[model samples]
Target: MPINCKKQTLPTIEKEQIDLLARLSNASGVSGDEAEVRKIIREEITPFADSVETDVMGNLIAQKNAKGKCALHVLIAAHMDEVGFMLVDKDSEGIYRFSLIGGIDERSLAGKQVLIGKDHLPGVIGACPVHLSTKEERECILKLESLRIDAGPGCTDLQLGSYAVFATRFQAFGPSLIGKALDNRLGVATLIELLKHCPEHIHLTAAFTVQEEIGARGAAAVAYNHKPDLAFILDSTPAMDQPSYDNAENTQYRTRLGFGPAIYAMDSNTLYDHRMVEFLKTTATENGIPYQIRQPGGGGTDAGAVHLSQDGIPTATISVPGRYAHTAVMIARKSDWENTLRLLTASLDSVSQDIFKNER
Candidate 1:
């Protein structure tokens, strides 16, 4: 029998794109301690950025001069932090106790592995075994109060107040991407690409924001400092497309993989600028790109703070869908990320001087 191998042609957005995301998603940047993630972004943008400034709040605000007359001074933002834990105390046996840094579901945290501090000390979030739990205990989900992070019995590198993050390594399989912190890492990588391909028609102000996991504080600072004509926030949103526990049709599938980027009209924060909304969807339609209207509901992005910055600014939000966000592992479709990039690039490229001329 002859040995057989098949030639494979990957997606147009291949290794280069995936590589950047891998580095970003794998880096640890929990809320306040964003230096690790910022370093990568700073180096990546140095060549393309006209000016880069690290704000007092740690927001990496970069400007890229337009190749031609600026049609719109557009502020584009992608936060650089993820939900994680901060070491609060070390237990008697060398195990540690930590408090969550951002919004994370404790119910699913037990047994998940983690990395603590700059050393990336490996650890696991341990929970009570089923054999030791009563029927009532098993009926309820695990809470933070009952958990401890075990770095092993003799570990000593970390100290109290150090940050910790999930140790999920980024992986690409077929069209699926799995990793930790894809929520905003995808956004961060996308923003870097946008800056490299900065649109000639707009004065691009890119904010690789910090502390978005802690109420979008970094975004708030950028908005006040940049004061652009309009803004677009790039981030990731949850794709609750999984099958419902009941096994019935999952009607609440807010976004499903392969559908395309989700356009935000309204979230828990600011209602996105209406004309900006029309501009985005129209661009997607004209370009024959698929897009989804994220149902008006709870949840928000950097735009929440940016829109309120400096009297007010017109804003729109877009997100690549990731399932199981704010958890140890997240899943996103490669196609969705590609489409998101396509939509954002096209929208930025064609943004006109009159885009904000229309009334609110």
Candidate 2:
């Protein structure tokens, strides 16, 4: 007998998820450098998850027993990598030259705190002083080369190969969260929350993917191997509620803070499965769970890689709305976090053919 969405028990996210998110946000994970973050995930997931494993590319794959039901493959993915800096060179005087691992606004690079090496050595990115710049120089865009990292007095002590991650730690701001790496750390934390109450018969696979900041490389491999009947990417979508950007015009979607989870209809990577999109939105509405759909054309998630794998799997993405993404201080709404857990758990519990039928 298939589980009915109406009859499914909704699971609530606890304070543990928030704590984990804060820890992950503070941890160092700059694209290829995710060993420490992976270790943290492994520890948390080892007990509750049925079979914990890692893919060739360092993707943490955790499996749960599924009563052996065919077409019951449900893969939920969240990238563990975050945008940060990587060493490019070192000057004769020992100042470090670096490049960004993920997309970062050049304007935000000036005077930002960062972590370098296994010792978590502190450093600050320095840009030319505004007073020193000429009118033409000030008008010019801040190029990546213009930024330099200051590891403080004894610069020779640091090596050229060390990595640099955003140093801003997580903070609770009003009803929203402000911290670094909330972009995907929030997504990872959501998956962790789901693991605690996940039903034994659900037959689900959750992956803490890597290198999503560079590309959707980690999710691509996992999807090809599992080839699940359905897949969902839990991630963070950038919010345009700030003053600089026009939330309605340039932005394709506008999901406010505390407004439940953002359900993406389309992104650069993949067109969401129509049935899955409708089911999730309708399910949330019927269940009184707050939710919103991404506009016609908008940002993408790991679902892009998962849906296009092997024979082409159906996929959808649920995101937590975040402000100042890619920057050190990212923010997520409290309600958005709670609502994502409710939505995903409900979808897992509600699995009838009628709900998935193309005709209905």
Candidate No. with top TM-score: 1
lDDT of each: 0.87, 0.82
Give Cα distance to truth, residue 240, candidate 1, Å: 1.0
- Clashing residue pairs in candidate 1 are none
Taking the tens digit of each residue's C-alpha lDDT, what string does model 1 give over 1-360?
001211121123679989999999999999999999999999999998899989999999899776666456889999999999998987767688889888888886898899989878899988887899999988888878779999888887678898999999999988899999998999999888888877565688999999998899999989998888889999999889888788999888777888999999899997988899999998888777789988788899999998988989989999998899998889999989988887887787677757668777
* Model 2 ranges with Cα > 4 A deviation: 1-9, 68-71, 243-253, 352-354
TM-score of 1: 0.94
Model 1 alpha-carbon miss at residue 36, Å? 0.5
On the 0 to 100 scale, the lDDT of residue 359 in model 1 is 79
Error of 1 at 237 (Å): 0.6
lDDT of 1 at 282: 89
- lDDT string for model 2 (1-360, tens) is 235535245665557777888899899987888888999999999898889998898899999777656547788999999888877798646578888888898888887888897788988888787798899998887888867888876766787778888789888767888899998998999898777567555677899998898888899999988877788899998777554444445443366777788898877878777888888987788778988775556567788788889888888899998988998788888778888888887777774455566652
Error of 1 at 61 (Å): 1.3
Q: Which regions in candidate 1 have their CA more than 4 angstroms from the true location?
A: 1-12, 68-71
Local error of candidate 1 at residue 328 (angstroms): 0.7
